[model samples]
Target: MNRLLRTVFLTLVGLFIVAPLIVILVASVSTDEVLSGLPSGFTTRWLSDALANDQFQVGFAYSIRVAAIATAWAVVLGTSAAYAIHRFDVPGKSLLRAVFIAPLSLPRVVAGFCFFVLYASLVPAAYGTVGGVAFAHVLLLLPFVVSLVGAGLANLDPELEEAARDLGATPWQAFLRVTLPRIRVSMIIAAVFGFLTSFDEVDLSVFLMPADTTTLPVAIFLRLQQNQDPVTSAVSSLMIVGSLALTGLVALAARRAGLFATRKERM
Candidate 1:
């Protein structure tokens, strides 16, 4: 009876989480009347319309470019910072860790506003450009990379590095051949998170995107502000599907790679 109850509970939770997504997916393909509850049948017109629009395509491409670049930067910087903190005996290590992870604690709006104001004051023309967006994204997502990579580093067995060193491997070679392979999962996770953060960002992108440049989230937001229709729903559903697919792939990959295991299990 207890096992049955647990299974039922999980089933309910799954339904609760997935029902909305299913509804959105259905609505994305719905006709205008179905969308408005006026009694029309399913139609793909909205999807076609969304796809045909130049703004949607441009914004999507822009978002992809920014997210890819930002994820790369975040992984590189975050991994390096985590490695330094984990490997070196630095002064005020606790304080440094706190400082490095501080960005994650700030409200998104507050951080975006702060960056916008500071950059405007220093480089007024920087706002509303790809560089500005990438910079903001890196700042916002850096903490995730640091934390995730740091966890991997913390749980790493230093004896492996020592063993490699004793085998006549140089420090660089040992890290490249041994340490990096062990932490590759953490790096992938950080990259995925960084990409998602940049792709879905709104507050910062709103301030940073130039008049000619926009991201998918920002574009969707602006469109919603002006109108709400099946077309809007279609775009939203597409974004949701894309995000979920990426997240699902990441989770599956992590599971397959044993990255989701506890430290004890990994050991």
Candidate 2:
């Protein structure tokens, strides 16, 4: 009875999550402009139109660029911070961890507003620039990277790094050769998370996006504010498909890199 109830609950939850996606996917291919009711006919014109939109194209390119840069910075900085916190005894370590992860608890609007206020006061010129927006994205994503990579670091064996050092490797060499290789999966996961988070972030991006350089999510939001159509659904569907494809590619890469071999063995 308990197992049946659990299965039923999970099925409902899955349906709740996936129903909107199904609607969007269907609407993306619908010939009808009104998406409130059933779709009239199937067509790929909306998808084609979305792809051909110059604004969407520019926004997509900017989003990709910013997300890539932010992901790289977040991974590098978050990994270093996580490694230090996990491997060393630092004063105020607990406080530091709390500070690092505090953004996760804050509302996105509040975070964006705070950043806007700070930038407006300290660096008004950077308030709506691409670099500034990217930096904000990095800050927003850093906590996820730190948490994921820190978990991996916590699970790692210190002996592996020590053995590398004993083999005449310098501290940097030991970390690069031994520690990083073991945590590569976590790094990849963090990168994926950061990229996706930045790409889909609307609240912060809306505030930070410049007039000349908008991100995809901000563009989508602006479009929605102006008008709603099947084109919006098509764009959203493409984003969903893109995200899924990226995740699959990352998982395949991890498998090829032997990151999952131990788990497979245990299973």
Candidate 3:
């Protein structure tokens, strides 16, 4: 009885969470405005129209570039920081860890506003540039990378690296040959999380996007502000599909590489 109740509860929760996505997916293929009742008819024109939009094309490309750069920076910095905190006896370690994860505590709007004010006052030129947006995203994403990689490192046997070092391998070589391969899955997960986070970000992008530039989320927001368009739904549905596809691909790759093997299976 308890197990049946739990299953029912979880099923309801899942439906609640997925209800909005289902609506959006239905709306994307709708021929008319979806405010009143069911769609008048089904059509694929909205999807094509969204894809052909020039602004969307530019925003998509820019978002890809920024997300890629920011994820790279976050992975490198976060992994090094996590490794250091795990391995070394640095002073004020507690405080240092708190500082690194502090950004995760801030509201995105507050963080964006702070960045905007700082850039506006100190380096105005950076206020609306791609580099500035990427930097802000890096700040937001660093904690995820650090925490995920740190968790993976916690599970890893430190003796592997030590054994490599004992075999006349240099410290760098030991890290490259031993430590990194073990944590590669964690890093990949971090990169995907960071990329998706940056790609869908709107609050921060709004403050940092230049007059001539915009991101997909910001574009969607602007479209809604002007009028309700079917194209918006089409674009959103595509993003959802793309994100799911990317995640599926990653899972497939990980499975193929035996990353998901249980201890019993390995034994």
RMSD in Å for candidate 3, one decimal? 1.4
The candidate, 1 or 3, that scores higher on lDDT is: 3
Model 1: per-residue Cα lDDT over 216-249, one tens digit each: 8888888889887778778888888888899999
Residues 1-267, model 2: lDDT tens digits: 999999999999999999999999999998888877887789999999999998899999989988988899999999999998998899999999988899898889987888888888899888767788889988899899999999999999998888988889999999998899889889989999899999899998777757667998888889999899889999999999999999999999888867878865747
List the pairs of residues colliding in candidate 2: none
Model 3 worst lDDT window (10 residues): 31-40
Taking the candidates one at a time, how many backbone clashes does each contain? 3, 0, 0
Each model's Cα RMSD: 3.1, 1.8, 1.4
Provide the overall lDDT of each model, using Cα atoms, as 2-decimal numbers: 0.86, 0.90, 0.89
In model 1, where is the ten-residue run with the lowest total lDDT? 31-40
Q: What would the TM-scores of all predictions be?
A: 0.88, 0.95, 0.95
Clashing pairs in 3: none
For residues 169-223, what per-residue lDDT tens digits would candidate 3 score against the true structure? 9999998999998888899999899999999999888888774678888888888
Candidate 3 residue-wise lDDT at 200: 92
